[model samples]
Target: MSEQSVTFRYRMSDRDVFYGGGVVNGARSITLANEAANRLMAKVFQNTGHCIEVRKVRLYEPCFAGDYMEFMARVRKMEGNRAVLEVRSFKIIEVPENPPYPSSIDVLPEPLLSTVVQFVYETY
Candidate 1:
């Protein structure tokens, strides 16, 4: 299979938060990673890839509103039609008072969310 990947940067808006504060739902993080993985399926695997299972999941912290979220994915391993994917999630703390307007997406020393997913597929 061809190696296809993508990186996404997103700011959690009001719609992404429901706690009446800056806190974001965990589902959003998972969605970000899932979306990346799905995109790889179509782009690299030609729509023949499917996620047979989620091997593992880990949330290091809560994502708040105004925080920048970055999603990254790649095909870690492939055997026949099955592939293992590694998806990484990073959350950037937003500082409204920062010099660069609302926030910045500078790479930080850590991440708020990280996940790994397993996929199975058939490719021509």
Candidate 2:
């Protein structure tokens, strides 16, 4: 089968900040990647499969509250009922430092890559 891909987007909320300086927890980014992988699995297999293993989660940059995050998932390979997927998250927009107002936002010239996650899923 040809590879299938999916994308998911979310706006980081203040509640997502678990650490100081409005920084979001790394697990939150992993959760977003998993959600994207789940969507891809459901689209490709017509069922929501279980994630059997997470091969790796590489963090390239930090995510912050008020950042707009984009997650992309693509099938890497498939064998029988198991499939391997790779997910990446990028920051599309961010709250600028020392903004004039609290709600000010800036769109990045290019998406800032935040994380990459690879996992294996199995359909029942």
Candidate 3:
């Protein structure tokens, strides 16, 4: 079950919003990206003796606040026990806002971009 591309879509909740409070930052764009990669790796190694672990993770873009985020993962290259994955997260800010206010606003915060992360797998 090798996947060249994987996409995960999720919405933002109040918990996901940070308003100068301690909420541990629920599900955000970065989290979604990591989860997408993990899910992709899980699919790639499904039922196989090989298991993958994220060696490094970085954000190339900053996830905006109050926006729906989508993470896309693509398998770039694969070696014996190492694989390179490219992931990009996009935030959609076209959702309608509450009434009795100003004009349409782009609540979507700047996406937390990330570079390609290399993952290593161990097989026995």
Candidate 4:
């Protein structure tokens, strides 16, 4: 097990909206999680790793365009050449409703957990 971790922050744009109401697709979280895992695995193993399986995934909240998200990944355990990574996604900021200004945004006092995923990877 390694205590190493990585964080990726992104702001959803109109391009990220997948459906009506600016709702982003749930699959986007998976993609972000994999990215976080890739970065973290490289730091932990000193080599690239390929995701072999997504052991578990849960989407707890909806993400919308204009949402600022944070993705984090940590090395949980390792066996031989296989490593397990835990990834979490959070919504840290959101666009305000009926904003008086175009750039109006609200930062959540407590980050909202949007997704959680467990990924298994094979290190080179």
Best candidate per TM-score, number?
4
Report the lDDT tens digits of candidate 4 across residue range 37-110.
98898888887678898899999989999999999999889978899899999999999878889999999999
Candidate 2 — which pairs collide?
none
Model 3: how far residue 75 lies from native, Å:
0.8
State in Å the error of residue 93, model 4: 0.1
Number of colliding residue pairs in model 2? 0
Per-residue lDDT of model 2, residues 29-51, tens digit only: 99989999998988988888899
Q: Arrange candidates by TM-score, highest first: which order? A: 4, 2, 1, 3
What TM-score, computed on C-alpha atoms, does each candidate reach?
Answer: 0.74, 0.95, 0.58, 0.96
The numbered model that scores best in lDDT is 2
Displacement of residue 78 (Cα, Å) in model 3 is 0.8
- After superposing candidate 1 on the true structure, give the runs of residues whose Cα lies further than 4 Å from its correct spot: 1-4, 96-124
lDDT for 11 (candidate 2): 98
Higher-TM-score candidate of 1 and 2: 2
> Predictions ranked by lDDT, top down?
2, 4, 1, 3
lDDT of each residue in 46-83, candidate 3, tens digit only: 52233366665555543334456677877767766665
Candidate 3 segments whose C-alpha is farther than 4 A from its true place? 1-3, 19-27, 47-65, 94-124
Better of 3 and 4 by TM-score: 4
